[model samples]
Target: MLSILDRYILKKYLGTFSLLLLLFIPIGITVHLAEKIDKILENEVPMTEVLIYLYNFTIYFANLLFPLFLFLSVIWFTSKLANNTEVVAFLSSGVSYYRFLRPYIIGATIVCAAALVFSMYLAPKASKGFNEFAFKYFNKGRSDRDQSNVYTQINDNDYIYVSYFNVTEKIGSNFTLEHFEGNKMTYKIAAGQIKFNDKDSTYTLFNYSKRKIGETNDILKTQHKLDTVFAFSMEDLTPVTYIAETLNFTELNDFIKKEKARGSSYINRYEVVRYKRWSLPVSAYILTVIAVAVSSVKRRGGMGVNLAIGISIGMVFIFFDKIFGTMAEQSSFSPFIATWFPNFVFGILAIYLLRNAKR
Candidate 1:
């Protein structure tokens, strides 16, 4: 079930979306680097380290820029269609507005799906390495790399605890493992110091002692060397304790669950980012509908007017998204809604305006 007009619109949809994202992401990175170049130079950062940090910043900025770039792409591309009278011609040729918009919807769906995959899977995986490089490369002070009270739970019933972990050195002290049986503690092992072996995905506890308070409260103690496998490896910790932007949706979800169960409040940022990663992808679809609805009306000022309004509205959406995200950290507003409220509200408004424009 397809038509020539559907194909035309699909071409425009994908062509514009891809072109804008490609163009704007580099522009964004350039602007970001230029602004920070002085600071980097003044700080006496090495050229290699500076470039690595810039790369990390650029990647994270690109992820955030996708929504705005997509919005602008739709607006400008559709304005061209309206300007050339192709839209009017389509209507005259018996193409209903919704029917004409179908290809756009399909294209938006593809973009949305791709966005989800990148944000939830690939991007996060990249972020892990990027963040580590950023920290290790640009750290001005040796003490800047220390981590505090790093605790994580690997499974529903199994837990891994590190009282004070040093991320810069990959060392943890006062480590403990407490196994649970529904609501009761069944096993407890306390270690003196833990070291992570990145190659084998295991933790080596040195000069450690343990006490097993279960089954009969039979206390067991040891010192010297203890080796064990941790549910999370060194790279996993980099995402949680170090950088919020580095984790994908699944990683964020698992991190929040772990920290929350461990009675840690520092995970609110990760929780918000988790919901945001899921919600941001559909923004492309919303922007497409809004762009078509706004531009097809043939305003008095033509394309320039439409572009200005489009950019303004897009900026407002970004502002609102940031505001709600901040409020999510400080208030009781549901983190899920806080991250996604702008997209949800704007999507509904776009539907209403699309109907009005057709009338």
Candidate 2:
């Protein structure tokens, strides 16, 4: 049922996209290595670890720049067709503009599906490994641990607050735990400082006091040092820097719900990541349409002019995405809006260009 022209265009579309990724990935790796070589040598990291880090970095970098690569590849190949007058020949043979676009749409759909899968699963795993290796081996001064004014809901009725927590030492100062029943406090424990003993898997609280609120009276007990076990652990207090990047779509949704309930300060940031996973996949289609429309017409300046325009548009798109993303992370802008704003704007532009190209 497939025609020769459809197959030809589809082949070119996918083949060029593949070739672009293959060529640029090594450049990305080399640049990254150049930036990190001094740190790697100074830290004296093992070759095995370096190899593993590079493997993970490959996945991370590819997923991060997939859209840019896709846009540029489409522009490159489509412009070549225009330069060769293949587009003119196809149109001269009575193929409608919409019909010619079908193969491109199908190709974009395939690539979009692959990108979705990568973002939801493989990229998360790679990001986790890559960031962990970076923080653990190369960047010794930086840590993934959250330390200041920590607050969270450990369970339905239990809440915790820590004024200061040192993740390296597994110690906390000015810690408070409260238990509530139907919005009424039942019991509370306040500690000047708490330390976790890894050997015994127990907590030691210094200058700790416990208060029990009864129906009639309150009973308070004070102790110099108390050793006990709690439902939570040190790991709960210290979360990774890119925790959102480590979870798949389902896990990210559940995490956002829980974090929202706990009034996390970084909820907006997590929501931005969640929305972006879906947005980037949709962008593949929009960018593909734009690329086809822009490069369909053979210009006086030929491929160079088309590529220059494509690169400028690509840069502008990235700039808009970064600005809106930062706004969502820092301000009250909805993550859903921030994540999709560039797509919405560019999608309209694609439609306009497609209309003009059709005429």
Task: Write down the lDDT of every candidate, Cα atoms only.
Answer: 0.76, 0.91
Instruction: Encode model 2's per-residue lDDT on 1-359: one tens digit a residue.
Output: 66999899999989999999999989988999999999899889899989989999999989878889999999999999999999999999999999999999999999999999999988999999999999887779777777888888877889898998888888999999999997999999999999989998999999999999999999999999999999987866666658999999899999989888766778888999999899998999999999999999999999999999999999999999899999999999998999999999999999999999999
lDDT of 1 by residue, 1-359 (tens): 76778778888878988887678767877886787667667777778876766666666666777888778888888888888888899888988888878888888888889888878876775566666654454444543332666565656776666677776668878777778889987667777888888788788988776666667656778879978876666644433454566666666677677667755545666678788787888888888899889987677788999999999889999998999999887777778889889988998889898999898
Per-prediction TM-score, please?
0.72, 0.95
Question: Number of the top candidate by lDDT?
Answer: 2
After the best TM-score superposition of candidate 1, give how far the Cα of residue 349 lies from its true spot, in angstroms: 1.4
lDDT of 2 at 79: 96
Q: Tell me each candidate's RMSD, in Å, in order.
A: 5.1, 1.7
Give lDDT: candidate 2, residue 358.
91
